[model samples]
Target: MAWRNALTKSMQELRIHLCQTSPASAGVRDFVMANYAEIKKVDPRFPVSLRECAGAEAKLTARYDFGVEKTVSVQGASSAAVLTQLQELIQLGEKMPKSGE
Candidate 1:
């Protein structure tokens, strides 16, 4: 019972956080979408516009845009490289930082 209550509370907090953060993220999505033409020339598979990107981001979180930006920022790099870097960051997030020497 306690665990279930804790889980419910955690989920509620997450929902609130999402609601607060989503608007800023939506703005970012709009900015990215406005630049889609330039971004698409860099990567053909990029979404067609900002609304699409925002929808995806809403489902996936800001990390999706971070990955896309990281992927596109490098010249002559494949999308796979961006995915690889994102994966590394995700893994790093799962681990604890080392103590000071």
Candidate 2:
């Protein structure tokens, strides 16, 4: 039963981490999505969408002309890491070269 005890302990730790971080991650997701909508205004040709995944994971998709698209996702163990990943995606979108540029 020693292995069983170890497994249970590991699962408990995982649960604790998720409980502590998930709410903050959700907040970050909302913040990023709101900011992304503003970014889309600058170039409506490239639209963005946000997806919430199980656990503390978030996905952002940027669709380009001609049905081309790219997705950026972050499954962070901490709130700060999630925020950083979201910010990086925004910065990258801002730097994306326009067509024929």
lDDT of 2 by residue, 12-101 (tens): 111111222365455455555455455445445432333344564444444433344455554442445554544454444445554544
Best TM-score among the predictions, by candidate number: 2
What are the per-residue Cα lDDT tens digits for candidate 1 across 1-101? 23222222221111101112354344333433453355445445433322233223332221221132111121222334333433443443334232221
Over the full model, what C-alpha lDDT does candidate 2 score relative to the true structure?
0.40
What lDDT is reached at residue 6 by model 1?
A: 26
Estimate TM-scores for all models.
0.24, 0.36
User: lDDT of each structure?
Assistant: 0.30, 0.40
Specify the poorest-scoring 10-residue window by lDDT in model 2.
9-18
TM-score result, candidate 1: 0.24
